[model samples]
Structures are given as C-alpha cells and as structure tokens.
Target: MADDTGNLELEAFRAEARAWLEANFPPALKGKGGLAMAEITFQDADLATWRRAIGEKGWATPTWPKEYGGGGLSRAQARVLQQEMGRIGAFNPLMFGMGVTMIGPTILDYGTEAQKQQHIPPIVRGEVQWCVGYSEPNAGSDLASLQMRCEDAGDHWQINGSKIWTSGAQYSDWCGALVRTDPTAKKHDGISFILIDMHQPAIETRPIKLIAGASPFCETFFTDATAPKDAILGELNRGWTVGKRLLQHERASQTGDRGPGGGGSAVALADLAKRYAGADAAGRIADPDLRTRVIRQQMDAKVHGLTLARAAAEAKEGASNAASVLKNSATHVAQTRAELMLEIMGHQGLGWDGEDFTREELEAVRGWLSGKAMSIYGGSFEIQNNIISKRILGLPDSTGST
Candidate 1:
C-alpha cells in the first residue's frame, strides 16, 4: 500500500494522501474535535508517523528543491497535498518551532550548497528544532541597535550578550541569530547573521513565565559562545539583508495563511458561535444587527485567506515583497476575529482562570493576549505601516531611516 501510494502521480497523490490519512490518523486527530481539544501536546508515535509521511512526500517543505531534501513537488501538487491534509484534519507536524518556519526558508534562500546540504534534510525530517534570537532587552522594535557582540578569533567568533524573548530556546537545538561583528561600524552595517549551537557550554537559557502560567519565550545568554567562522549565513558584514529576508519569512508564517488545515480559526469561530449562542439565539447570531457583524467578520476572514493565497501565488510568480502586505493584513484580521470571538461569548469571556471558565473562554483570553504581540513580534504594526507607506506607496522618506 505504501509503495502504491509512493508511486502515485500528481492526480493520484491527493487520493493516496486522503486514504492514508483515513487509515492512519486517529479520529481524535481529525476535523473540529482535533483542533478544539485543549491539549497542544502530540504523542511521539503520532508525530513520528505524520513526519515520516510528510517527509517522504516532501510535502513538509513542498516547494523546496529536491536536491536539498524537499519533495520537489510543483506548486499545484503542493496545493493538492495541503487540501488532502486539510480534508483529513491532520495537524502540521512542523508547526512547533522555528526550524520549519524561519530557519529552513532562510537557509533555502541564502545558504551555501554545503549549508543547504547539511541543514535542510534534518529540519524537514523533524530531527532538529531551531529558534529565533532576534530580540534583546533593548533591541526589539529597533532591532539594528542590538548590542550582542561577536568577536573574530581567527577560526571562530566568540559571542556575548543576551537575547530576550527567544521563543522555545530551552528546547531548540540551533539558533539563527544576529550579532554585532564590528562595533565601530554603524548600527546595522556591521551585523552578522550566524547560526549558533544551542548545546554549547557558553549558552544559558531561562524561561520567562507569561501571564498564562506557561513560558514559551526565554532569555538566552551567551558568554564567549564560539561559532565556526563558516557559521555566517550570508556576506560577513552584510547580514542585514539576510536578516530582513528571514524576517519576511517569519512574518509570512505568523500570518497563518499557509500550509494544511490553515482555516482552523474560521471553523473554530463557527463552532464557538453555534455551541455557545445556539443556532437561533436572539441578538446572539440570529438577531439582525448581531448577525450582520458576525457575517461581516466571517467575510473578512475569508477575504484574508484568499488574499494570502494571492500573495503566495505572487511570491511563486516572483513578487518577493508580496508577503509584507499579506502578513500585515492577516494579523489585523486574526486579531479582529479574536476580538469578535470574545464578544460573542460576552460574560463568559471575562473569566481568565478557575474551572468555571469554559474551554472557549480560556482560549479566547489567551488568544486575545497573544494577539497583542502579533503586531509587535514579526516587525510591529507600525513597522508594516511604514513599509507600506514608503516602499509600496512611494511616499517620501521623512524619517531618513529604515
């Protein structure tokens, strides 16, 4: 059966994927139940099975070249793969961290043949977890002013300073980070984008507990952490270009506009409305005024999804900067949906803790809080506005800075 599935042509791949998923993926991991279930943890066997299947088909990183351990599938085939995965309600096995999200794409764009050969396969296979080390205590919004230094030592660079808000750093095996390679140069001029081994003695990570009690972000410190001279991702003193490209990919991923089962938010929202307010609840969803708002939000979510698809198509057609607008717009729409979901719940939404809080309420609160950071993290809302104003709109550069 596996061999037959493997031999499937483009048309047959979707059918095979659907059949395989039906047979292999548990019902609990399928459809609305799979997403609504509060637990974020995945069983090792389940993860392994899904990863092996996606990895074999290169559906994990579908558009990447075959030589660098990708599925070498056409964009059309990749879309089919996504549709099949969505039909089965199979969650993305690579959605956990930066390995698949940021680093993998960055390496594909800027990495040498050697680097691509070394890095891409493991990441696609889920053998490695990577994290971003872009933010520092004082250097988040104004990222170029970062003070983390990397000193040349003939064959290696000794790194020092701290990175704050390093997501999943404690569990990450590698970090694609920015460090100051030349202190005398201007803020952004001398920065170097380098890959750092997270298991080294000089690295220390302390998780920062959030208001929700779980800490997904960490403070990472480096004390003379050594990286091989070849760890540089792009040109030595021209890392700003590489960093910007990586940021573009990160922003695109955060838009939640790609991959299989991507429309979970809309489905979740519909489920919440029906379960909480009922099918014909007055002034809830059936009420004319409230119904208008609900319908508008649903339309907006659909528009956002379609816009993302257009942007992806544009990217594949050589419009590289299309992601910027799609990302900014998608984040705004998602935040709006989160707000509406809470509004639909009304009184029940107010509760943050305790068993009295329904799963919907808990999710709403966490999502609302997290949505606040969506505008800030992958370049702030302000930053995106500036990009649109200057680059897309051809506005005058009043600030004289990027």
Candidate 2:
C-alpha cells in the first residue's frame, strides 16, 4: 500500500512536469535537442529559444546547486524530468559538451566560492563550453607523466605544452588543464589544475580526422599561453588528486545513465533485429540464438543501470574510482550494442552516406566505428583495470613484487 501511494505521488509529479514542459518547450525543437556540436544545425531559431528557456529554468544542470542557477532537483525529481522529456521526444537543449558533464561537476566538487559563483552559473546556463587537457603525446594512460609546463608570471601564469585527444578543443572557450608547476617535485606531486582561456594567440588547435569522417577531437598547443593566477583549482601541487576527481566525474558522465539528456534514444536491438532479420510467430525474433543474445545484452544493460543507481544513491559526498567499474561496463554495453546493430543490419549497415541506405543504417556503421574508441578514451580499459585492481581490490603493485 505504501509503495502504491508513493508511485501515485510520482505519477502526479510526472503529470505536472509534463504539462509545464509542453507549455514552455518550443514545439519546433522537439527531438532536436541533445545533439553534439558537430551534429547541430546552427541556424535554427527554435533551438536557440529552447536553449535559453531550459538554461534559464536551470534544468540542464538539474542536480547542481540552485544558487548556481541549477534546478535544485533531487535525484528522483531529475529522473522524472528525464522521463517527461523522453515521453514527448523533447531533447535536452544543452549540447553534449564537457562543461555540463565533466568540468561543471568537478568544479562544484573542488572550486572555491568565487570560482563556483563565476564559472558554475555560465556553465549551468549553457553559455560556455569547456575542454579537458590531461593527455599528451608522451602521457596518455599514464597521465601523471604529463610534461605541460605552467610557470609563475606574477599576476598570471605562462603555460607551454601540447595536449592530444582534446575533444572539441577547436571550438572550446576555456580549458580545465593539468600542468606541471614544480619541476623538482615527483611527477605526480608537481602537477596543478588550472583553467586557461582558449581564445588567445598563443593557443592553437588542429582537428584530428577519424575513420568515421566526423571528429570531436583536436590536438591543442599552448605556446606560452596566459592564465590568470587565480585560475588554480584545489591546492597547488596537489592536482593529481584534483585531476583524478575530475576523471571520476568524467567517467561517470561516460557511463551513459539516462540523465536529463535522455541519452538512450537508439532503436532497441530486438526491434531492429525483427525489422532486418525477420520475426517469428507471436512477434518474437526468428533466430533463436540472436534472440538469446539480445536478451542477455538487455539483462546486462539493466543490471549495469541498476548498479549505477545504487552507486548514485550511496554517494552523498562524491564519486570515487569505483566509477572505473561503471566506465568499463558502459564501454562493453555500448560496443556490444554497436556490433549487434551491424550484425542485424547485415550489408545495409555498412553504408556510409547516400540514398542507398536508411539514416539509421548509416548511423549504425558510424556508431560502431566511433564506439570502438570508448574503451580507449577517459583512461583506457587496461588503465581502469589497473585502478580497479590497485584501488578497489586492494591488490599490491605487480611491479613492486618483482
């Protein structure tokens, strides 16, 4: 009886949320939200209006602090908002940038009062974009070995180094970068986390083309670029701690739990298989083995999602490296789905672009290619395994033993 009552309350809240969204959300922009920058059509007036409305409402950063222009929503309420948005095919007006998913959460965790007031509001409003600078040519998975240098320059800092695989670097307004501030200290101890403006002459970005023909990544160069002295986040020379926290947030973002953005919009694998591979009587997928695989994948995805919810429920303070577990699981689920998509579509999924294949088919091929990199980015699968081993499992260092 109590569970039934609680569910009734939730339904009432959902109805209210649905009504508000219908009245306020622009009709022309339905299903057009949550697009990556590369996928967005800039000329659409409706998109702009919707962005403003959602940003002003503070629902884009729903779980962030209300004082920082966030929605002040509980996790349950946030889920309701997501459900309501998905029901009407309403997309999140905020673009899929590092600001909301990665940087904003980290800043909220570590930023000073002034930094929070200055940065979080703009981010919550979707007024700016951010990129992370952690990886370098010599330091990808082993991030503590990074050599980007930031020197004291009185009122500001002079930064010089290059960062590789910086997603959306070419168009970012600011960067949350990890740099070496003390050469004499140990590799991990010498680092600092700082924010640097990207619109300066000393900063340059070159996009890296990928097999998918679309790229969100760039190689970013900093030739004595300037950052205000006050831009340091957390403590100086303790950025390894700060950087790890940021990565925890990042891995959380990549886990793809259906948040305010309603990220899981891809066609169901079973439905696709039925459409492409034909269906048996009673509307079941014809191939017994394929149907079993789909069921297994679906079960795994649900368990992964439930684990995420439990983790979210447990973490009142902040995320830990346990996010690494979710990151690996999400990578597996996403990559598996992409592979299954191709298998279902057969030759049709191989099409790139033309009238020859459906839009869904072309997207599947590209998605499969792009999904391959998920295990590599945000720290590789092997890196996550190391973390899970050393940190979570309390395993002794293998190198120390030999």
Candidate 3:
C-alpha cells in the first residue's frame, strides 16, 4: 500500500526542510507565535530577519502559486513544512497580516490576472499588509445593510464612509472594502468590493483600546479615499459573492489550518497548574475538581484539532458548510484554554499590572479578556449555528433574511 519511491522522496524533502529551518529560524524567536499575533509593526532585528527569510524562500505563503512568489508546495509538502517548523518551535510570523489569511486568497479567487501579478507577490513576500472594511457602525452582523459610498470619479473611485471594528486598519497598507456603488439597486446588489490604498490622507484610523490593553481593532474613516478605476474586485456590482467568499477564507484561518503547534512559547496548562497550585504526590494537579476540568478542556482541544484535520482532508479548497461548525469549535477551544489557564493561576492571574505577577500571569489575564471576542468576531457563535442548521442540516431559514 505504500509508495516506496514517494516515501523516499518525501523523507529527502523533510531532511531538506529541517536543515533550511535550522539555518533560517531565529532561536530567540522560537515558540513566539504569540508575539506574531500581537505584532503590527516590525522593529526587532530577529523578527524582521525571520520575515525576510521566509518571504524570500516563499514559505510564508506556501502552496500559493509560485508565479506569485509563493513556495508552490504541494499540499502534502506544505504539511511537511508545517511539521518541520513545529519541531523547531518556529511559526509563520506572517500570520499576523490579514493579507495571507483573507485578502490574498480572495484576490486569487476573484482578482484578474493583472491584479494577481501586482498584488499577490507583495503579499506573499510580506512586503504589505491588508485589512477588511466590512462592519460599519450599523452593519455589524447585517453586513448587507452597508452605507459606504463608492462613487465612480471617471479616473478613479472615491470612498466616503466609516468602517468600525476594522482590525489592523491602523497598520494596514491596503484595504479590501465593500462600498455602495449603485444606491438605487437592492442592498446586496449595490455593494462592490474594492481595493483601496490606505496611505492617502483621506483615510484615518483610530485604534480602539480593549480590556486587554492595546489591540488591533480600529475605527476607520474614509473622507474621500481613492482607488484606481481598475481596483474593483470581480464584477462591479457582484461583490456580495466575493465578500462572502472572503468570509469563508477568514473562517478557515481561525480553524487552526495555518500555524505550527509549537509557537506561543506557552507553558502547558498542567505544568502551570503544578507550579502555581502545587502538585500532588502522584504528580497530578493537587485539586481533584480542577484536575478533572483541565483534563476535559485538553480533551476538547484535542478533539477540535482532529476535527479540523478531518475537515481539511475532506476538502483542501472552497467554502464548506463545515466551516461554521469548526469555527465555533475553534472559538470554544481557544476561549476554554484561556479560562482554564486563568483558573489555574487563581488570584495571581487577576493581576493587570504589577511586579508581583510573572509575564505569563499578566498575559494570561489579557489573553482571557481578549479571548471573549472569539465568540463574536468572524461571524458570531449564533450566526454559525444558523448557518449549520440551514446548510448542513437542511433546515429552512426562518428569519426570512439573508
């Protein structure tokens, strides 16, 4: 049943990957994927170097077409790369950028040849960052009810409106935004997805501070943000389809398909429990009740990981109804991990700031706070349930709405 030649070749490739990763991955940044999640700017030499190395090697966007500067690894080869990186406690620093997760894949799907040539390479190279402008003040879950005006200005398009909860807008170089191009048309029909340049003065971003301290979420305003006439993604008024497709991509990223598991440099919950709460004679968590709950949470996390792997194996591309199911599952695993961690730390985890708390303790408090949004963003928990009922369960849409 085994392909000997193929197995031999794969093993050879694995060796090459291990060597390359050893040569390139910075030891100081090992298991630091949490830093990548929080990083909006590159200031550290090691971080910058790691980004450059991966970008040049095209491993940052591995499996994307090589013509666009991606590694163009086969799906199997990509998994091998992931395993190698995990072994070294190396993670893709580029995961912080929305360019790879939402925008780049959407562009590949909906963009023209010229658009791909111009945009995809820079994204793959980690030379640019992107944000999505979807949720307006009034259009949070009801995204179709957007009111941003995108006027055809002969030579270019002018965008005038605000997008709330625009994550990373303050740092993004570009934005893929939806705008009302035909006000007279129906709500969904009038919307067109456009690629906007964020460097212009017409665009302003105000970061929304969170309970966890500084965050990427921002309130973005466009007084008269301009884009090229050719900046429209897909057909002009058919952007709802493109927008929905991008949402699928966003869900996929949250499903744990990307990162190597070794990052975050985090202490295992059990280890933390033993250290902070004291270990029993049997080397188990001292408290019986807390020990049972921690074991349950870890089981749930493992089940979630396996389910993700199954969903990935079933289909490597396209939007599947499984996304809704797994998206919620991912939120559960992440949030539960944070909660269990906080509980394990007990009173010490409550520290917002002080010399009394360890760095991990302070971060755990923030992480727990920030993890609350996991249920809401990327289409909320309730939204995913509705999707599952309709798409996966063959239930009717009772809300009589999109």
**Candidate 3 at 6: error in angstroms?**
2.1
How do the candidates rank by TM-score, highest first? 3, 2, 1
lDDT of 3 by residue, 1-402 (tens): 379887887889899999999998999988778877765654678888888999999998888999999998887788888999988789998876789999999999999999999999999888998999999999999999999999999899989999999999988999999899999999889889999989999999999999788767999999988999999999999999999999998998887677433366456888988988898999999999989988998899899989988887888555688889999998998888898898888899899988999988888898899889989999999999999998899999897877
List the RMSD of every prediction in angstroms. 4.4, 2.3, 1.9
Which residues of candidate 2, in runs, are more than 4 Å off?
A: 1-12, 26-34, 37-43
For candidate 2, lDDT tens digit of each residue in 1-402? 998987898888788788889987776655544343433335566767777788899888887889999999877888999888877777765637788888888898889999999999999888888999989999987889999999999999999999999998887899999999998998789899999989999999999999988768899999989999889999999999999888887888788663675543446899999999999988999999999999999998998889888888787765577689999999999899888989999999999989999877877798899889998998899989999999899999897756
Predicted model with the maximum TM-score: 3
| Off by more than 4 A, model 3 | 260-262, 400-402
Q: 151-204 in candidate 1: lDDT tens per residue?
A: 999988999999999988888899999989989998889998999999998999
Error of 3 at 199 (Å): 0.7
- For candidate 3, what is the lDDT? 0.88
Model 3 residue 209 CA deviation (Å) reads 1.4
Reference-based TM-score, model 3: 0.96
TM-score against native, each model: 0.88, 0.93, 0.96
Whole-model Cα lDDT of every candidate shown, in order: 0.77, 0.85, 0.88
